[model samples]
Target: MSHSLSRLPTLATAAVAAAIAAAEPAAASRAVQSRTVKINGVELFYREAGPSNAPTVLLLHGFPSSSHMFRNLIPQLSERYHVIAPDYPGFGYTVAPADFSYTFASIADLIDAFTQTIGVRQYTLFVQDYGGPVGFRLAVKHPERLQGLVIQNAVANVEGWSPDAVKQLAPFWKERNTETEKPIRALLTADTTRFQYEHGTTRPQNLSPDAWTMDQAGLDRPGNDAIQLDYFFDYQNNVAAYPAWGEFLKQKQPPTLIVWGRNDPFFTLKGVEYFRNLLPNATVHDYDAGHFALETYGDEIAAETLRFLDTLPDK
Candidate 1:
């Protein structure tokens, strides 16, 4: 599941490309400039593109990934809208205090402060993986502020989970047990890169080695395993709250789009069905790609997202 560099951009190079591409075209461009906003005591790192006045689209990544996940898609969408992607605390360039609790609720709280600091009262949410729990917190709490919800390979329904995920993360579901934590940390190794890439995509040939390495580095970092372990523990709580989350979706029913990778080993295509059932008005697109469908299907996703935004009520 490795793609050559000549065909794809590395994380750092992709960031620069996004920025440069954004600056060249006044009409359609994306930049990779970064800004830090202090939320409580944590400083969140964010990258943005397009005109500030353009409609805002906030992109959220999953565990072990940063805003860099949207490196390709942002530039494409920046043509007609503003794209903002932020690194969740403890991942990417953002820093988290060693003692900080990395629960989803805490992360959600930080996102709330982050949006306010950026002066975006209303925005279209582009959430993936861990972004599901984090973004749902914002959607559930501030339903009025969301113009649309664009979900990419995330679980809103418990049925969407794969058996492998349940197996790998099962030990930590109830609470963090030291025995279960060891293998959880082991998955961060270089070997898991192939597993990660293959799980997320149908076309393993398209997976970029650098992307896998970037994510691996973050997971392999000192103390980072604790954050992931905490997230694993919090995810059980998220699973328990799934019913309430579905009810929230039914109640709020914001304009939504569900773009999923059928091959995603973690959040299975069942996740898309969950969103469809809850968001009866949702537009669902299941691609042959894997969990990181946006990476392989950025063009289609960007186009679909723009169309989804078009269907939203005027902000």
Candidate 2:
């Protein structure tokens, strides 16, 4: 059989001249844009993708991470949903005023202003790590504005915390001193940051070094350690709010979805049960991955998220 020149792979064929798709996974069809806005006296950096008119998915990142953490998942949903992932003050590219307080409540207030500034009236809140507390505060404050909730590797209960954090932070919450802050220092190290990405993931080889390296760079910024320490102490307030957040979930019951990494070092699978208890109807999916589950299973999680989002009643 004679093959046509067009069908053959050769140096002279046009196949090599055609536009080559990006080497990234097909989940990234929608181009993600990095944008910054001046709001609430702080410069907030966020990644935006998809049609502005489409349903919005507000992604709130976890501790020691910024909008960069959502890099993989944004493109997966951007084609059908308006996805916005922002760096909190003192995180990523966000620039906060010197006097700006870094407590979760304050950060939540700023984020509230951020949504109003950017005109996000309604959105599905996707929270991970430190995002759990921040997103909950927003949910409670504006229950009417939430289309739904997506909990990823974050917790509203004490059972979800890793022993290392609770052991150190619990005492710090009780009393902040050099003795209490010592272990806190260890948690903030670059080594610990790298460990977070590598510890429980199923495929370490597939994970990007950029994730933790970028996070460590953010953490290494001058005075960021103080901000992080403040967060460690402020987390006590979050623990106190669990009852109220639980009540909010029971009372509001916005359509809920829970996606988690069963092997996360910080947030245990047990913490997910808190939501399952409050939101019996909430959808749940867990993977063998770690805290940054999307790094390993973004496609699977995105497929699940698309299915769940499809079922929700539009605003």
Please report the candidate that would top TM-score against the real structure.
Answer: 2
The residue ranges of model 2 lying beyond 4 angstroms of the native Cα positions read 1-29
List runs of model 1 lying over 4 Å from the truth: 1-29
lDDT of 2 by residue, 211-301 (tens): 9999999999999899889888888999999999999999888998999999998889779888898999999999999998988888898
Candidate 1 Cα lDDT to native: 0.81
TM-score of each candidate? 0.87, 0.90
Worst 10 residues of 2 by lDDT: 18-27
Residue 266 of model 1, lDDT score: 80
Cα lDDT listed for each candidate: 0.81, 0.88
- Residue 137 C-alpha lDDT in model 2: 99
Candidate No. with top lDDT: 2
Clashes of each: 8, 0
Model 2 has an lDDT value of 0.88
